[model samples]
Target: MTAADWHARAAAITPRTELFIDGGFQPAASGERFDTVDPATGRVIAAVARGDAEDVDRAVRAARRAFERGDWSLAAPAERKRVLLAVADGIRSHADELALLDSIDGGKLITATRQVDVPGSAAILQWYAEATDKLYGQVAPVASPDLAIITREPLGVVGAVVPWNYPLETAIWKIAPALAAGNSVVLKPAEESPLSALRLAEIASAAGLPDGVLNVVTGFGVEAGAALGLHPDVDVIAFTGSTAVGSRFLEYASRGSIRPVWLECGGKSANLVFDDADDLDAVADAVIGGIFGCAGQVCSANSRLLVQRGILDGLTERVLERAAALTVGDPLDEATRMGPLVSARQRDRVAAHIASGRDEAELLLGGDALPGDGFFLAPTVFGSVPDDARIMREEIFGPVLAIAAFDTEEEAVARANASEYGLAASVFTSSIRRAQRVAPALRAGTVSVNTVDALDVTTPFGGVKQSGFGRDLSLHALDNYTALKTTWFAGA
Candidate 1:
């Protein structure tokens, strides 16, 4: 489609003004609400339900009822697959509308939201839908004729706290697998982005998802999010956010042993460049893409760069030039390369990290906030950075890349492994030997050699260390949300 046509179509997508709870769309029960503002213009885009602890309880109760009395859990696997497949088809039908909502709600480029996130979401849902019927219990051989065994059950209600970045995609990531595994959900969408989740309910209902099976309560982390995390009825709490908050949620859930938890958290991934690398300029751009894509909002963003001392200066110069060339403006504008952060608070946090870099490392380029109404931070880079600097250690969660020099593979491996966050890392050397050599030493859940973060919909995307635990986006994703059972039968 033409760019003009795409934008025009994106403009027509509906902007939902209410929250979906228990098969109904309504204003806040507390008579309170929050305004969603455009980070670019700082204008109130819309007012949405301001869910609280009470609302969380209400949602959880509904989910509990659905799981208990509802046919969802006890239904045949084929029946469950039918409903989930319908939900998946519903998502595909509303892809344009959902993408548009995401673009407006969180200020992501409409192209990305449309082409990548939305389609990716549909694929994820559909994949899980098919897997529902395929989920099986293993048969165990038993020697005794008197023994009989069987296994299979749902965890009941699940409380999912979705992050602002890739709101709809993240929600679908956990929700699809959970529901396919026969669990009802209470989705606590981030305050900054909740419109699409509301719309998802509509699509699901239209697709024939039963009442009370899936509910959403949009609110801040302190109220709805925390409540959902600690709710006694919630059998599982799947969260995607910071490491610190993940720890707190883990602690809260572990207190009673009532429910288990899964978290996908922070990262300071290392992207190493070798002197023998074939594509230095291309490598520079890939590095930038890995770090600055989605305005550097990703948890597994390649924020740490370790270039061999031989090519450090060259790579640094080229990367800085391209990063400076990035056009930071309205997400709706097709010409814009970088968009605003999720909120003003996010912008401020990124700014603080940039400022702190002055004391810990040499400022390379793009640190100061630009003169604009939007939450725009010029794509930033820091040089002469130690492997142990605060900028490298903390998840800045912005378009800030830190560059450090290393002389050998051992040094590069050491530097990359120094950070507590081992989410993802990349190597840019041309030699297969070099890639094979270094891939083992880098401490991360996933490593992409000769590329940045190229995620397959089928691969298990997750992290190790302080970056949080649990996998998403693959067969392994199902493993975390679903339980396994072994069936034993006695043969005479």
Candidate 2:
């Protein structure tokens, strides 16, 4: 659809103004509400129910009841798979609408929502649904008279706190796996982009999910998120957002029942390009996409570039030329390659980082915000950045790249590994030896060879150190939602 058509359609679907609980939309107990604005236009789209501790209590009660009654938890694996697949189908049918909601609410390119986010969300649901029935138990070896078996059981209730960037996809990343493991979930989507998540609740209900199996509370993180994190009834909390907030979740877990918390937080990942790399042009393209893709909002974004000193100048020039060619404008425009940041506040924050960059590093390319209506900023790059520069060490979460040069493999690995965050790292080289050597030495949960930010549904994704713990995708993710149980019986 054209940009105008997409905007018109988005306007036509009056935004949902209620909280989703027990499989239905309802007003908050306190009757409080907050306006959700379109980040691209700074216009209020809807007055969503402002969920507080009271609302979280209600949602938790609903989830707990559903789990205790075995309405969904005790259901057959095939039945759960059928319902989840149906929900996936619902998402596919409403792809355009969902994509529009995400684009406007989060200021992401509508084309990306259509081509990447929405479809990826559906595929994740389907992948987990198919794996539900395939989950297997183990029979332990023992003496002839004794038999031991180990099996996995769903945690009673799961609380999922998703962030604004790729809200729908990240929400499903938690929700799909929790449900497939036969657990009722309480989803607290980011307050900035709650519309699509509310829509997903409706679709899941229509897809025949049991009432109370999946509930959503829309409100500020301090209110709803903290309550979910501290609620004793919640057996597990899966959160994806900033590192500071991830720490809060840990604190809440400690203050509550000490339930396991799965956190996927921030990153300042490094992208290393060696002198022996076969394709400088391709490496340049990957470097641009690493930081520019998703407006550099991704947690695993390769924001730090560690280039070999010999080829640093040539690659940096190529990257600058490509960055200048990128089209930046309204998110709904199909021709637009880059869109505004999620909000004016985020844009200002990025601008401040750029200002600091001016003093700390050599400004190699764009650094200022573009002249426009929305929160637009030119893709920025900084060269000769000191190892201790704030722009190099911090998570900018914008289209800002910090380039540093190193002479040897040891220096490259040392610079890449020297960070408080170790979420993701990439090495570009044709040598199998370097790929094997560097991938393991990076200290990141995910390391890509000859690629950057490359992820799939079947592969585990997460971080190490302060970037948070636990996997998000793949069958391994089920470990966060399910508990292992051992049973033994002796034959007389």
Candidate 3:
């Protein structure tokens, strides 16, 4: 569909203006509301219920009741699978509407929302649903008088807090596994982009999910989010956002029930391009896409570019050319290659990072904010950035790339691993030996050879160090939502 079509549809669909709790939409207890704006137009798209501590308390109580009732937590694995599959189908059926809502609310490209984000969200539900029935318990080899069985069981109440970027997809990353593991969930989506999540709650309810199984509380982190994180009844808290916020969740867990906190946080991933790389052009393309494809809003964005000194100039020139050519406009525009940042505050943050790079490195190209109504910043690149430059070290979370030239393999790996974040890294080289050697040497969680930001549902995605802990995508993610119990039988 055309951009105009999407814009019209987005305007036509009545915004869901209430908090989703216990399988229904309701206003906040205080009746307070906040407006969610379109970053592209700087206009309010909808007035969402401004949920607070009381709303979170209600949602948590609902989730706890659902878990204790055993309607979802003790259901047959196949039954849970059936409900999850129906949720996935519901998502697919409403793909266009969801995509449009995401574009308007988050300022992400409509193409990406339609083709990648919405589809990815549905696929996550389906994948976890299929894994439900396949989950198995292990029996320990014991002496004749004793029998030991290790089984996985759902944690009662899971509270998931996701970020604005890739909102729907990340929500699914947490919600899908939590539900498949037979745990009731209370999801708190980022306040900047909560529309899609509210819509998902509606979809899941329509797909036959029991009341209170999947609840969404929409509000600021300091209020509703804090309530969910600190709620004593919540068994686990899964968070995806900045390192600072993830740390807060950890503290909440410690101060409350001491429940486990799973975090998939920020990153400043390095994309290392060696001189021997066969396709400099392809490497250049990966560099552009890695940082700018999502306007560099991704938590695992490859914001650092480490290049061999021999090919540094050539690769830098090619990267400049591509970054210059990227089209930034309204997210609903079908031809837009990049969209505005999620909000004016985010745009200014990226701008501040670019300004810092100007003093610490050579501004290669595109370092200024564009003149427009939306929160648009030019795709920026910095050359000869110092090892200790703030732009190189900090998580800008925008379309800003820092390039540094290195001498040897040792220096490349050392410089790449020097950052506080070890979320993701990419190595572009032709030699199998180099790929094998460097991939293992990098401190990041997921290292890609000849590619940048390569991810799928089958592979686990996360980070370490300050980037935070815990996996998101694979079957291993279920570990965060479930607990292991060992049963012992003696002299049966």
TM-score winner: 3
Q: Provide TM-scores for the models.
A: 0.95, 0.99, 0.99
Model 3 misplacement above 4 A: none
Any runs in candidate 2 off by more than 4 Å, and if so which?
none
Output the worst ten-in-a-row residue range by lDDT, candidate 1: 139-148
Better of 1 and 3 by lDDT: 3
Q: What is the per-residue lDDT of model 1 for residues 1-492, given as tens digits with 9 covering 90 to 100?
A: 555676587556657766677788877779888998767668777888898888888888888888887688778889888988888888888888898788778988887998899988988888988988886665455566645454556788888888888989999998988888888889988899888999998888778787888999988898888888877778888889999889989888877556678888999998988899998889988987998899999998999999999998899999999998998887877788889998899999999999899899999888888787888888999999876688988899999999989998888898899888989999988899999989988889899988898687688888899988778887677666666565555456
Looking at model 3, report the run of 10 residues with the lowest lDDT sum.
1-10
Error of 3 at 152 (Å): 0.6
Assess each prediction's global lDDT (C-alpha) against the native.
0.85, 0.93, 0.93
The number of residue pairs in model 1 that clash at the backbone is: 1
| Model 3 C-alpha lDDT per residue in residues 206-235, reported as the tens digit of each score | 999999999999999999999999999999
| Candidate 2 lDDT by residue in tens digits, 116-153 | 99999999999999999998999998888889999999
TM-score of 2: 0.99
- Model 2, residue pairs in steric clash: none
